[model samples]
Structure formats: C-alpha cells, structure tokens
Target: MNQSDEVEITLQVCDPKIIAGLNKFIVYTIKGMDKNGQFDIQRRFSDFKTIRSFLLTKWPGCYIPPVPPRKAFGNLEQQFIDERRLMLEDFLKKIATLKYLWYSEEFQVFLKTPGEIEKALLSVPKITNEEIINKYQDAFSDLSGREINREIIQKINDFKAYIQKISPMVQNFKQIAKNIAEAKSSFQASLIHFITVFIPEYENNVLLEYVEQKERLIFANLIQNEDAQGLINQYCDLLKEPKFQELYQEVRKEGKQLKAFLETFAEREKYESQKANAESRQKELQLELQEVLAGKTTIRTLFSKGKKEDHITKLQQQIADVGKEIESYQFICDILTVLVGYVEIDKFKMEKQFQYYNMIKNIISYEINLSKIAEEFWSKVLKSENMQQQQ
Candidate 1:
C-alpha cells in the first residue's frame, strides 16, 4: 500500500501484569486502534524482541526506535517494567507513523492477531547449541569474507562506541541545565530582594557615599531615581575594570561558540533525518529491482522482456544514488560527532568560567551590607542627639 491509504494507528501501553490465561507470564497489554480495526494484544517483552529482529531484517529502511534492554532476572521490578512499557509504546508509535509499513502484512499480523505468531513460534523446531553453532559457522565465515558486511559491522560498532561516549556527557548536561536554571532563579531573586528590601533601607548610605566623594554634589530627594542611577553607574564602573572586562569578553565568546554549536547540531539532525528517508527509498528501489528481475509485476509485460532489463538498470541506479546519499550522511554525522565532542568540552569549561566570574556579583552585595551598617549608625547618632537637645 502507498502513503495515500487512509490509515491511522494509536497505541497505549498498559502496566505490566501477570494473567491466568497467559500462563502467569508477565506481559504488557497494548491497546491500539487503526482504520483497519482495533486490537488488544498481550505481548511479552521477548515477543517484541523477536518481532523487532524480523523488522530489522525485512524492513531495514524503516526507522526502528530502540527498545529497552531485556532483564533476565530483574524483570519483575515495577519501576523497570513501567519504563520499558513507555519505551515500547514509543517504538510502536514510530512504527505506526511509517506509512510504508502501515499496510505491511507482517506488521498487520503482529498488531491484529498475536496468537497466530505464538502458534508459529511454537511450531518452530528447537536446536541444540552445538547444532546451532555448527550450522551457523559457515554463514559466519561467509559473512566475514564479504567486504560490505564487514564495513556495515564496523559502522555499527562505531555507532555503539559513539553512543557510549556521549551517554555520560548527556547525563552531565542535565546537571548543567539545572545549574543554569538555579543561576537564573538566583538572579531573579536578587533583583526582587534589591528592589523590595534593600532599596529603602540601604539606599541612603550607598547613594550618599558619592556625595562625600564629589564635594558640593547636591543630593536630590534621598529616595529618588537620581540616587538609584548614580549607584547603577558606580556598579557599572567597577565592572569596567580590566579583570571583569576580560571575563565579560570570555562569556560573550562562549555564547557565540554555543550559537555555532547549536546551528551545526541542527544541520546534523537534518542530515540524519534525510539519511533515514534516503535509506527507506533505497529499500523500495531494491525491492522494485527484485520484482522486475523475477518478472513478478507488470513491468515484465509492459516493458517487454528485453526492455525489462532497462527498468532493473534504472532501479539499480536509484538504489546506488540513495546509497551514496546515505554515505554522505554518515560522513556528516561523523564530523558532527567530533564537533559535538568539542562543544561538550567547551560547555564544561564555560560553566566553570561562569561560576568563577560570578563572584563579581559580590561587589553590589558588599555595598548593600556596608550601607545597612552605616544607616544603622546614623540612626543611633540622631537618637542620641535628639535626647540631648530635649534635656
């Protein structure tokens, strides 16, 4: 079926539970509906793995989301089961969104009647480990002999390595996000405290200090915007010091770097998506090529047997083109990996620099405290003077 099929699918992952009908095996009940029909399928985690392997083999072009790792012994944990259910739901949603796979017979069978799959699995003969190894040894030897499979294997390893490297960095990024959030909260709170609490109390001394420095400087109403502006200017001058200036420049530099990193990251994601599309198209082309060669479609009669070769040739060309596109995306992704690594390093350094330079905020804090003390001192002095005058 094509993209025009009026198809829609929705799935909900239920909490894991054991049931009597299912032989007490802990399984997830997935409730879903589509234009074709609705279904409630009880599936064990192992069932998902089996079907996923089939999908990867038969529909390599589809973007299959990763599933949660299997737990042999700890599968009974409620929290782990919940997380796995969420991930499984996500995977199903991705499969549903792939229009090409929506009408796939295997996928439909999987969603509509899972009991059929169970029966098929039951019919399959089990082999001993020795027999399995002996039977697959030749296949493994043949696979190792093929350059293409070797390259694919290498790419898979590289992908896994990249994920391993980035996993900790991604976790660390959560802390960075939290740190920035707290910093912002602190900044906002400081503004509120300065305006609401510190201003009326400390403004007299902090603002009047300049009056002592500049002789004959007339102070406007003590609590006016004029005093606040003077204090702001004084604070600005302190920040203009060379040490603070350098720190400010560093922050700006880091900000620009972050902008660049974000732009490159967006490009990387775009190309990655494009690669997925191209790979899907490649699979289509390959399938078409197979059909033409096998004379399984109208191309054999319409194009004539002799000209049928031309269709196969054209399909092969399209497949090659998509393959090249996939390669280009892979190269771009590799470069992006390096760039992201650098960005992560830069981010760590930037966080440290920000924490160090944030000490500059203490200047205003110190001014506020000193002004509070001075205001208290003057209040005492005026009270004593008034008492003496009354006497």
Candidate 2:
C-alpha cells in the first residue's frame, strides 16, 4: 500500500460561487481528507467532466459513476449551482471508494488541482489483455476474472440497446406524474381566481361577496400553492406524501452498481469512434495506392509503388490492430455489464417497474380526499352563518 493512497477519505461540496467572466461559470469548494491530510480546492463542472474522460480512457469499461448532466443554460442560478454541487460531491465520493481509481497518482493530483489536469495525468497508453485482468481482480467480485470475448460484447450491445429503448418510456411515466401534479395546481389556481377576484367584482352582493371570500380563503389554504409549487401539487399539498410524492417514492431507483455499469458505454463509444476512423483511413490509403500504381510505367511512378504498397500494408495492419483492441475492451465491458445484470444491481432491486398505473390511482384517490375536505369546510362555514341568523 502506497503512503499517498487514500485509505480513508471524507468529502463535502460547498461555497458554490459563480465566476463572472467573458463566459460565466460556476466553481465549488471540495473539502477532503485522506492519509495525505485535508485539502480544500475549487473545481468547475468541466474539470469534473475532464476527470471522467481521463478515467474512461485509462480504465475503459470500469464502473465509473456519472455526475449530473451539464446544462449550458440556467447553470448560473443558485439552485442549479447547489444541485450540481451535490452531484459533483457524490461523484467524487464514489470514486474515493474504488482504490484502483482513488489511490492512483493521477486521481490524487486531480483532487488537489483546480483546472484541467490533463497534463498532470499520464496520457492513456495502449491497453493489453493482462492489464485488463489486473485492474479488475477486485473491482467487481462477480467478474470472477473469467475469460471474456467478442460474443459477450455482442450480449452487452444487445442488453444496452434494450435498456436504451425502455429508458424514454420509463422517464415519460415519471414526467407524466409531474405533469398531472402541475395541471392540478393550474386548475386549482384558475378556480380560486374565478371565485375570489373576477366573480366577487361582478356579483356585487354583500352576502355573496362574503361567502366567496371565505371560499377563496379555503382554496388558497388548499395549496398554500401561492407560495411555491413543489413535486406534490394541488389541494393534496396538505398531505405529507400526496399522490406525486407517493409516486416519486414508489417508482424505480437505480442502484450504484447499475449506474456505474451503464456509464461504461461512454468508454465504449470512444473505441467505436477510433475504430471507425481507422477503417476510414485504411480505405483512403488503399485508393491512394491504387492511383499511384495506375500511373504510366515511368521511372518516377514505378519507383513509387514500393513505398505506396508498404504504406497501404501498414494502414491495413493498423486497422486490424484497432479492431483487436476494440474486441479486448468490449470483453472487459461485457464482464462489467454482466456483473450488473446477474448480481451487482440486484442489491437495489433494479428489476422494479415505473409504477405508471399506480400513479394514476394515487391521483384519483387524492381527488376523492379533496372532495371530502371541501365538503367539510363548506358544511362548517354554513352552520356558523345559520347560527348568526338565528341569534
């Protein structure tokens, strides 16, 4: 164990400050301590993203968790800055748990450095089969360090495709619940405005105005919706965990291992892009060699064939080498993905559904509850008025 390695670490993100420059940006205060002692450093979102890129390159197919998605707009707002701060803080803490990542010299530098750490970290070297096994011997217990191959890569591809297909629909169901809550608030607002303001102005009867005022107060209290709109909207806002909150709590939540496993796709995408470029370059070299060979048999053209032929052969070999690396990396990725499918993510009940219909049921039940509250309020108000008239 290296003396510099962080066996114990504590982290907190704070002091989100927005920099007003030619281009606006935000930075966070990351306070952390390990064996190396405590340090406070300021880092930007792009800096965190850069570290992710570095990790992906060095440890392809490793389970690197994601930070929050970058937002070009609305990022300067204090709320967004705080949310991002929490996410970045979470990302760093996860990395700290993995000795392969957190204890590395590169990662140590990244934590203390404020800006781009690209020059500080080693450039990613070409990967070897042995290196893959060495990095993962302890990373995932489920991997078992078994042999991996191209066929498993195909399995990973197919599995990821299926997940991607279902992702939108799962997200849409949650969004719909949010939308329903929003619509309830909108309707609640419109009804209150009609009863309190517009109707009171036109009706012009003292008794009617007095009754409407009470009605307005009731509806206003219904949400206190005037102050703010949160997840659980509408008259049900009175409930601790109303329909929306119930649905939010009930639905699917991703486990850390599953989240980590899914993020490897970004690493895979890089190799896919590299292979595509190599293949394209090979084609271009072949065409150039042909043109050189096709020229009239002159001294200059004839002599060029040897060089052109060698270049084409070299290009072809380069493409094949890239293909092999892609295969090896995909094998690693497959092992990680399977860990999630078979055992890793089961720790979180990753198989749960989105609870769409359940959300609808909650909404309907909330409406029923609202009806009861409205009746109770009206009944009490009228009883008080009748007692006043009898007196």
Candidate 3:
C-alpha cells in the first residue's frame, strides 16, 4: 500500500455550541484526524450541504450517500443535534475513503483551514440546469450509431433489471422502519396516559374516599373526636378544591409530554441507525452499476469457459436470497402492525373499564368500612348493657 492508502481519516462530532452572530445558530465542532494531524472545525448543517454539492459536481454518476434532513423546526433539541452529528460523521467517512476526493486540494484545505471554505466554494461554479440538459443531449447524439446504442442500451437494461430487484426491498425496509417508529410512538403515548392520568384519577377519586369513610365511621360514636373529624373534612375539602385539580391536571400533562418526547427521541435514534444501513447498501449497489456502465469495472460475461459465469451465478443467488429476506421482513412488519393495533384497542378498553371499576370499588369499599365501624360501636353498647343487667 502507498502512503495515501496508509492515511486513515476519522471524524468526531463534538457537542453543539451556539454560534455568535446577529442570528445565533447551533453548530458542532467536527474533529477530523488523519495520519497528517488533527483539526477542529466548527460548521453548520449548510456547510455539509455545500460539501455534498461539491462532491456531486466533482464525481458525477457516483452515488453520494444521503445526508441529514434540513429540518426547519425543532433543530435545537440536543437529540436532534446529536443525530445530525452522526450523519455528518458518516458523510465525512465516506468521502475520506474516495481516493480522488480525500486527497483533493479543496478537501485538504477545508479540513486544514475551515475559515477559507467560502473562497474554496466560490471557485467551483454551480452547474446550471441548462448545461446539464445540453450535456446529456450531446452524449445521446454522439452515440447515434445503432450497434453502439444497442449494446449500451442492453447494458443499461441489465443494470436496471438487477437494480429493480433491490429497489423494492430497500423501499419496503424504509416503510417498515417508519411504521414501527410511529407505532412505538403511539404505544408510548398510550402508556403515559394510562400511568399519569388514569392511575392518578383512580387513586384520588377511589382510594382516598374509601379510606376516608372508615375514619369517618370510627369517629362517629366518639364524643371527643372533633380534631380527627376536622382533619378528615380538611382532606375532603382539599380534594374538591379547583386549585388542587388544576395542579393534578398540569402534572399529568407534563408527565405525558416528557414521556412522549423522550420515547420519540429514542425512536429517532433507532430509525436513523436502520436507515443508515439501508442507504449505505443502496448507494453501494448504485455505485457498482455506475462503474459498470462507465467501463471503469469489467462487465461479467456469461458461458465464456471462465469464472464469469460463476460470478454471475453467485450474484443471481445473492439477489434471490435478498428477495427471500425481504419477504420475511415484510411478514414481520405486517405482524407488528397488527399487534400494535391490538394493543391500542386493549389499552382503550382498559381505560374505559378501569374507570367504571374504580368508581364501583370506591363505593363498595366506603360502605364496607362504614358497616364494620357501626358493627363495632353496637357490639360495645350491647356488652355494656348486658354487664349492667347481670350486676
């Protein structure tokens, strides 16, 4: 391996800090390291966008991996910042592995002195839409020969056929990830509602009242129980107060909000991880196809009394295996959807039925407590009377 091959580039995204300017924005310090040295560069998401554009212009037809979405809202959250940081790191790593890209003067300069990025960017004019159209049009005219066109067309068609097999699988995987994430969100919300709202309501309206009734009946026959009765009345009055109800509602709302936010944040992390793997594989296949079309890589020929036929057979088997794996994933996703639906239904029913049972239990428990206290008081009175008669 040459010196260039020995050069290993690594990128680390540091914690985000607020950029000082007229309009303060959050930016992260991307720490880049190679055999040469280490450099710390602070950049916003737009900087990454510019870099992607530069790459596309420099390496046309080469697959560029997807970047973090340029979201206009909620970008300030620490979790959002962290997720984007990871994506940016991945983007840098991919670029570093490309020989022509990593060693470019522009890339080296950007890494060494980020302050001069604007100057570097200005040197490469954005490709005009008209120019792009004209280039393709001229290319087609150059390939006007029927034989040449037929061969190129056949190669393109074969490439498309192979890609078509992988495309659906990639699409299905993304869809499954999306549905699972949404379902997880819904489940989290339902669970929070059950814990914060339903459970609290049951405790306050049912348990408190049941316990209060027992105390009330026990003090009914005691002449000197004014202090105890007053304490019980105070507790009942507090339960009825609007301020107390408002506070309870606020707490419940906050609990749900916090739980939902935390859970959704975690879901985003998991979704991004799954998405990165899919996108990487998709881009790999796309780059391979592009290389084949561009004549950079030799195309496999069939039945030529060599390893070409074996190579093609191996590729065909891999595609078949991927198709089977996709089918299994689809089945699993379907089952998960059904299960999530069932859980939602059960959760709703539980909420409704629990409230009813809660009310019934409160009433039954209060009556039972009162009856026990009354029975004890009467038993004492009867015993005193019987003792007087015997004396």
Candidate 4:
C-alpha cells in the first residue's frame, strides 16, 4: 500500500470436507502477509466468489480479478480444487499491485477480517457510480481525471468493438486448453487402471517397483500440466469479462443519462413554457429591483415603504434562486461529462500485458515440469533394464 509495504499470498492448503450428505466443498487455507505482519485465513470457494463479487460491484471502473468457474464435483475434484486455489492466489497477488485496490476497504476485509468476510463486506460502504468515478479519479487523477472528450469516447467505442471481436477467440482457446486438460486427466485415469491390473499379474514382479515409480512421475506430469493450463483458461475468462468493458458501460450509461438530461432542457412541449415564463419573470424582477434602488418606484407601491423594500428583497431572492438552479444543472453536466469522456482505455492494455505475461510464464513452467517428468521417467526405465541385465 505504501513504499515500505510488502505483500505475499499463497493458497497451498485445501482441505476437502463433506457436509449434509454429499454436499462437499473445498476449504482453502490462505496465508499472506503485509506491512502489518503475517496472517492466516481460511476461506471457501464461495468466499472467493464473494470477494470478487464485492469488488466488481463496488469498483465498476477498476479491475476486479476473476475467480475460477463454478463446477459440480467430479472425479477430478481434488485436482480442480487445487488448480482453483493457485488461480485464486494469482488473483490476490494481481490485486495487491494496484494501490487503490490494495487499500480498499472490501479487500482489507478479505485479507484481515477475523471472521467470515461476506457480512463485513456488506458493512463496507456502498459507493454510487458517480462516487466510483470520483474515487478512481482521486486515485489516478494524473492519468484519468480529464473530461471525456469526443475523441477518447470514439477510441473507447472502437475498443468495445475490438473486445467483442476478440472475446470469442479467447473463449475458443480456453475450450481447447480445457479439452487437452481433460484428455490428460483421462489418460492418467487409464494409466492408473492399467497399473492396478498389470502389476499383480507378474509372478516374479521384478519390474514392478520401477513401473510404479515411472507411473508416479507420469502422473505428476499430467497433474501439473492440468494445473497450469487450468490457470490459462481462467485468464482467458478474465479477458472475456474485462473491467474495461464494465467501465465502458458505465460511461455509456452516464452518456445516456446526460442525453436524457439535455432532452429535458429542450422539451419544448413540457418545459419550454415554464422556462420562458421564468426567464421573463427574472428580467422583470431585475428591472424592478434596479428601479427600487434608484428610488424611481413610489414608496407607497406596496402599502408602505418597508413593504416595497420587502418586495425588492423578494425579487433579489428569486433571482438568486434561479442562479442556484442554473448552477446545479451545470454541475450535473460537468460530472456526467467527466465520466463519459474521462480516461484512456489503457487500463485494459496494461492488464493485457500483465495477463499474457503471467499466462506465458505458467505455460513455460509447465513445459519445464514436463521435461523433468520425462527425464525422471527415462532414467528409471534405463536403470530398471540395467538391474534386470545384472541379475
């Protein structure tokens, strides 16, 4: 949160517990530290979803990190749950880098709140869309405080179309990764099934232990591959449901409101007569007040000189009230314009860089792990052959 602050988060412990007859869930042991010191918290998958939902609602214009997709318990529940934990850690670590979000009340509740966070998150003050705009501007005034101009609005419009175009491509890639992961899982299952049948069939079983060791290494490769690719898919989901799109919608919504607001000013049928009458009366009062100050109107104009003065005072109040009303309308226009045209869409551009960087890193690490698995498997195979020849 500050220059001296350090943060670390990892979700390595997931204890699967069953409750109420077949309703099973994963409870993750989230451990982390901050400038305050190290702390540990336990949260469920629902809890992760809860925190993400809170952030999404409260910070419409900012990036709210993605959570793993909700899926029913399957044969690969443990592996999937483990993969989800890793992804959740990535989510938190990404959030920690953004200072505004790191110190956000909702996130702080998630990181340090003593008990269940959902209720506490409710206690976190609700911010309106206008307020959200102000909050982001306060945080990134140098970058995003400018009024939304027609040029930037057009750029955002282009970006909206671009995201729509790219989202399906990302979704298709996620599907492919998912298919590969599932196929590997099935392959691992077949290998386990074969090992059970094959190992006991050997009477001497001289090759038994070596086969088992290779099996374990092969299993590790498949599991780790699934783990890594699972994250890639999660990242794809993030790209599909991006914060830029949400912020764009916020701007568009405000633009629509502004349009309707201007329409109110131009509604000749409904407001034109009233506006004309108010303007005419204001002019009349101004002229009359000027004449009163100049002593051009009679003191007996309103039964007494004091009543005549009171009339002048009332005219002054009416003009002031009209001016205040005009200022209020202008203020609303200013706020709306600032939101609809503010900020470059570079937030997502930067996020794309981050998402791709980390996604590629996971991919490279997964490949390296596969190489190690291969090396270990081959070494075991050759050593087993040597032992058999020596015997």
The candidate that wins on TM-score is 2
Number of colliding residue pairs in model 2:
0
TM-scores of the models, in the order given: 0.34, 0.55, 0.41, 0.53
lDDT of 4 by residue, 259-284 (tens): 32233222212223444555676787
Candidate 1 wrongly placed segments (more than 4 Å): 1-4, 19-24, 116-391
What overall lDDT, based on C-alpha atoms, would model 2 receive against the true structure? 0.60
lDDT per residue as tens, model 1, 1-391? 4444655677898968865564355688889788777889888887777776555433322233345566677666685677678768866876676544555555666666657465644443443323323433332233232333455445444543654565556555545655664564465456545543575445356745744532222223322445345554444343333232323333333343333334434555665787788889888778878777887876434656556667777778888877877886665444444333433334444654765557456545655754564465334434443234545
lDDT of 3 by residue, 159-201 (tens): 3354445555545554554565456446545644553366546
Candidate 3 Cα errors over 4 Å, as ranges: 20-24, 121-179, 192-205, 208-391
Model 4 misplaced regions, further than 4 Å: 1-23, 128-134, 144-147, 183-347, 350-391
Error of 2 at 193 (Å): 11
Quantify all predictions' global Cα lDDT against the true fold: 0.54, 0.60, 0.50, 0.54
For residue 371, give model 2's deviation from the true position in Å: 13
> How large an RMSD does model 3 have?
21.7
User: In model 1, where is the ten-residue run with the lowest total lDDT?
Assistant: 214-223
